[model samples]
Target: MRTWYEGAIRGFGMLVLLSGVGLAGATAARAASLDPAMLPKIQAATFEVVQAKPTGDTLSYERPLPLELLPYQERTDKYYSIGTAFAIGHNRYVTAGHVLLAGEASLWGPPELRDAAGRVYPIGKIEKFSLGKDFVVFTLAQPPAGDAALEVDASPALNQVVYAVGNALGTGVVIRDGLYTSDTPEQENGAWKWMRFSAAASPGNSGGPLLDKDGKLIGVVLMKSANENLNYALPIHEVLDAPSGNAEMESRIAYQLDLFDTVENSQLKARFALPVGLGDFYREFQSRIDANSDAQLKALLARESANLFPSGAGSARLLHQQTQLDGFPTLIVRGSDGEWRRAGGQAQRFALDGNGYVATGAVANNGLVRLRRPDGVAAATFYGDAKSRMDLLARTGMFQRAVAGEKVKITSLGKPVRESTHLDRWRRPWHVAVWPLPYANALVMAYSLPVPDGSVMLVRFTPPAHEHDTMLDLAEISSFVHVTYQGTLAQWKDFLGNPALQPATLKGIRIDFDYDHRFSYTSPRVAFSYPSTLQAVKPDNLLWLGFRFFLDGGKPVWDVGDVNVWKDTASDDHNNVNVQRYVAPPPGLDDDLSGRWRKLAEREYPYNGVARYENDLMKINAVVAPAAAGSQPSTVLYTAFYGTAGTQPQADMKGKLDLLTKDMRVTEH
Candidate 1:
């Protein structure tokens, strides 16, 4: 069961080496004793019953024309819907990061998958989805019957006959066969390359299943090619065996809340979008599916049916208000008129006060009713406008005080906004503004303001409540500043020595970055020399520009400036302008710099401006004058890095390293 070195074929004729064993590319002969009827049974067994939705606008493939052997034969030129997904234990599934995220994300490689019944399920918990490797793991709110899920097997034989099962071009479940080609080296979104025998795969098959001859799970069907037989798959085991993150249910829920929190300093919640509140409940549900204990699953379902609300709020009212989803618990509160009510409970009071506060709470089993306070509202407001009400609640430590109190001075940490807020002309880019430090309660928010044309002013903000003592300290926040002069590793040493910046002591450091380069040149043809040969001679010579930056863990980290080569489009040329702009900032300061730059771009450019400058660095090109072209070098590029700096020199120090230069023969762009 060990994964063969020649893992399997992937990405349109691409072959890859598996992690454990090496084998020849010769295809395995079909098992002569294999039962053809088993194909459907095996297909059912090997196939993972997926319950999913499009991460975006996936093409809905048309069914095969009435008489054709192929499903999309007539629709070849048209688009088909596709999605990415994975199996959970034995009867569940998962998908890519983008699938469940809505809005602009649909443009990116979003989530796309469906259940056995052809019913699309709402993505529930995206426990582990990462752009670093272009993989995501999620669960459906409800599980579908009939089709069972597949398990992940890390090891597989090389040169094995493998088949992929997917909703190719929306033609239902299509099975394609292929060989395990190779495993991608280093880090890449298409982590493991796959190549297959059948041509059934299309863009819609990504994250599908690639099974072995015996129908045991093997890899995930991902990429495909125009040539009918070429396709790729990600090794299934690698995905399952990869690190399981520590993201918790509450944290994830809080993460979701943060997305719409309207709080100025919330980024963690914004970056990742998934169901946070119900993640744990869904996890428990998934556990039931994996164990195959239908009775236990039913028991869990009964728990789900248990009232989340208190009694006397109306038991029959709640009983008549239930809505059932296939996988998860659904309760729809309704009005006396029978129309579905969006409110949580039946007897709840709803009103928005001048302070924009709403009050609601449920009674506990102890007969004590508890009050739910709206975010950012003063506690004193619970018993009128007096602060004594808050003190009383504090002393009572009881959340169930609906009694009226005298006019009290109400206070809170600070008022929160319902709408998005921006700080114009900030000190640094907004992206890296705040970071959760080692100490609890302590936060390091950095910003950069536009200085002169070529420079930027950087600054850091620690909340006023950041007490030096550990008594109130949560996480001790720190920063690192590394600056590279123009893109050379030598800049690393230079920034390390600068007096203005100090690297944070002991803990690890990272670099964030932003860079821009522009150039122009004319074609290399002399005037009048081509007059007679105008019909045969080409006038314009292609002008090219290139750029690149080194990044690790999405953060510009180490120094590998030594990996130099001829600057091509992929390396750094006219074709790679977009790539050039994606430079990772040098350790420490890069994070802050990126954030500051993002804010600046948001303010200066505003609305959709981020799309224009999405790259970590940017490059522009134009034709140079022929005479000046000879005088000037054909290649030019810029490099930069930032590290640590700030008030708590021992903690908040971060900086950057940068440089710009030209290439004659073409080296690192």
Candidate 2:
């Protein structure tokens, strides 16, 4: 879970939670002088927008809710506050548009209003909405019977003492007083004027009433000023005079894509008839959200098309380069010199229960987690159980459930809302699962690949409203993920047998092992079999197989390119063997590598082609596979090597290979 500082509420957007921190002045100095009847009327009209408490908590906190910070009675309430809303008469209530939008895709019960007496009222319809001005007007399904609405006064005098009333710090309605400091032009345009005041605006105060000395409503508190105590409020006239029959929302969203240092600006505007049910409005708003986001994405890409991949000199060089494929995903950036290179953070391991560890690398807008399958969990069970997989990730702290900017206990995501698979560029099948975060209007996605020991997971968040585009985008980006899969032969058997986790590209691959001392790996390009003497073939032995890209008839294809098998032990001294697909140099390459390539091709054409060498530091035995019709400038070089730890006994290379290849069968396309 992430840590949040109170004054600067990071994750909850503009819903900042400010407690009794140092204000512009002391509480006594900020108190207002209002008529005795005014406070009661103001309090009655103002209601705290909230969501009903769930029957049981899906969220568990690192510590219990800070109940000690609140009054005894409020420590355990039936509802939690979201923001403030107040009656404007005529069954219409007003609040900050963002406050209402918080409920847009939330799983928390739809936005409701709680009165000073603790009575909860349902919101009926969204009568009017405006994203640009940040104000919303809606009708209450069952407004309490009484004359609780405050009188609207559009032209309250400047420099007059006023009370900013709302659920400050979520401790009921707080009336902090200050002067109407001045008038300022709204940032978007000078089309409207905002009432600047000296009173402090807490997070829950977003849609509260700004009352004059006589209790006349002048404005609705909206935001805190960044540079000064002159907080901003939308003049009541704006919300009161918005077009009556239709709800129009227009906003200019400043958005940027992850990994690329570029921004896309787009204006989103929509209009629909008022008196519409909350559900219909939500559908319309979500539709517009996708259209606007799509425009921004397209424009972001189109603006940099010329310098993008496959277009500029940087991209051309990158395409010609052979990437080393066994690392976390990274951003391919174009340098000032027109060269492309990968950028990423080093991996850091966080220990979890059992032998499992969460190996993480920091990246923008997304998370990368490599979980070491815990010692006791069965590989087959982990791969087949979706809830169990997510529950394991929940413990990693990256998968979380939060409220009021505080991290909570997340035993599980409950269940995945959707599950599917996407085959990455290397033909590795990535299982994709999405869980809803209705409270946040977003969804958490886990794109995972099951390996021998655990899973290589790519995680990110998206608005569930944008599901279609988000899924497509996720599939496209999956091509960039880089990870390695390795474990015991027993683990591999369990991993490969799950059809739900396998993609068609992996259908042609085969891995088999038996207690009878036989082991083998097969693919469309090559098939090979060897006995235990080749490299100790046991259920517990470690094996690593990875893929690499090659130009097949000038069109690139990924196939088995590297293989490793070894008897891993507690001590550093151990024997290992591998077969690597070594590509020959292209034109203009350096001479040293060219010479090495020549020797390898020559070694393959004639002779038994077995090579062996020994030195003070290590022992080596190797051979190059014979050329075939479809074989490229790439050659398969096999090696069995063991380090001597300077003075330890060196392996008898010739003796090991003699027994290794004695019963080996090889096939090449």
Candidate 3:
């Protein structure tokens, strides 16, 4: 997904498509004689650029293979090979500016030089740089022991034989020969020119020196046209002749780098925070793994696996595998012998061998079974369901196929347990059953709960005889499983119509604000909580609701104050609550807030000891309380309405307001 300018090679072909502009035919220039004596001086001037300790993290897309297979290739700690640089002036070197700035904020580190003998010389400061021209000039703290500097030639004729020397892929310094192809104007402006060549250039060839036959430096190789041998280099005259006294260049570089840093931070926040669509979520997850170092990648994968299976009583060790099918996240569960896979794009079908077992089509694969029961039986099964009535005698044949022709009896059955949580109303119903299989010497317990759209979630538990006294709580394990429906109604109906199958969308469930911590603002005077889902307009100054109802249009509805809380009015309603705290004004300003209560006893209409005020726009409930004895009074005000004068407060708005007001308390300074 990276663009051509982003230094990724996949989009390099586009460069050739744009190469035909502003080029004209010219006669080839005569070749100059090679100076054998100058070869040693040119080689001595060339050095490999390296970053000993990189400050920025390196992000790579290629998946790493085992390095042990190639014993000769050893991994190095060096994070960046920013192409090559050579001495242009006394203790001065020049390189392609992009080699230093290509990755945005993802590229950072103090640059140094690795000479032919492996000696490192650190760069002292940046002397000059031109981002548009892709060239930089810097001085070294300690110059290498070489007095020779390549003289810059401002003009090179077309088709002149040139020598390109630089570190190729960071392997070593290499010299390649080719003809100076032509000239083209720089893309940004016609103020500068580029020397086109037919020389070979790879990633690490950037910032290297382009030398004429007489060994005079003419251009600095910057990039190669994608899908062709045509390479581009910036004339060395630009770097040598550019004004070095420009006062704003340093600040400009800092500003651009800072922008890149901000973008990287935003990307990290989106990956770990917020709800992204299915495709983006998977891509972001994979990209993180690919970018991480070996040690970091391994740790992240292990943590992800642990989240899929949490430890609890009677919990089965299920192997989980996930893949995207039809752009939706699909999950596969594997047991000892049986495994689940997609069947005809409708539902998941379990392929079980002779050792596997199944209950009725309605409650298939929902529960676990035990090989042994507490009564020392050979085999037993436990089953639970939310949809079916809790009757032990009616479902005795639930596991008839598993223990074929064997005797089994229902030992005990529990009443259906109704469950409710903060996120949903009390509608979940489930029951448990324990059965003994004498032929197999095992006990089975089945527990099930109803899922969305009239489907049942079942769990089967089979514990050993000694652990029989310590019953495994199947209800607790079932509570953690989450099922989501993504298909159309016809597809959903088709899935529900088939009792023997389940959808592949059943996997780890995510809850809003479950993984994210609340954004809390605490000062010496006050403190409160707001869901992390809200975008902070001025962080602690204002918070905006990320989503809107049908009536809200596209405008941002938000709140501002020391501590505030906002919630939807009700189910299928557009109204919401906006609570703000107002501290009592100085002695002279009390008259402006005419309806504000001075104390709890002054109000005639007080519900649960909180005063109320009503206007055409909203209903305000205020509770005046002191921060401490003899301190100024503070009023916690709860207002229920929607967007300036849009909708009336719902009938139960006061009840919801009271819940938020109860948590609002004055803090001691």
Clashes (backbone N, CA, C under 3 Å), per candidate, total 130, 3, 32
How does model 3 fare in lDDT? 0.42
lDDT of model 3, residue 1: 9
Return the TM-score for each candidate structure: 0.29, 0.79, 0.37
Which is the leading candidate under lDDT?
2
Supply the TM-score for candidate 3: 0.37
Model 1 sits at a Cα RMSD from the real structure of: 30.4
lDDT of 3 by residue, 1-669 (tens): 011123222223355211110111111122234566776777688877765443322211123324334223223333345567889878888887655443222223445667766677876656665545666677777787657688878777778889877777556666778899888875433556788897676667788899987788999988787767888888888887876633111111100110011111111111232233223332433343234322332343344333222221111212111111121111222223332232112133222232221223222223322110111211112222322222322244333322223333332233322332211111233444444332222344444432222223343433222112212223333433333322222223333344333322121111122224443434333444334333222211222221100101222111123222223212112222343333333233325343343433253343233323344344434443434636533333322222223334454445445444444444532
Q: How well does candidate 2 match the true structure in TM-score terms?
A: 0.79
Q: Please provide, for model 2 over 304-357, each residue's C-alpha lDDT reduced to its tens digit, 9 standing for 90 to 100.
A: 777654355454444433335453445455555755555564477767776677
All candidates: CA RMSD (Å): 30.4, 6.1, 25.0
In lDDT terms, how accurate is model 2? 0.65
lDDT of each: 0.30, 0.65, 0.42
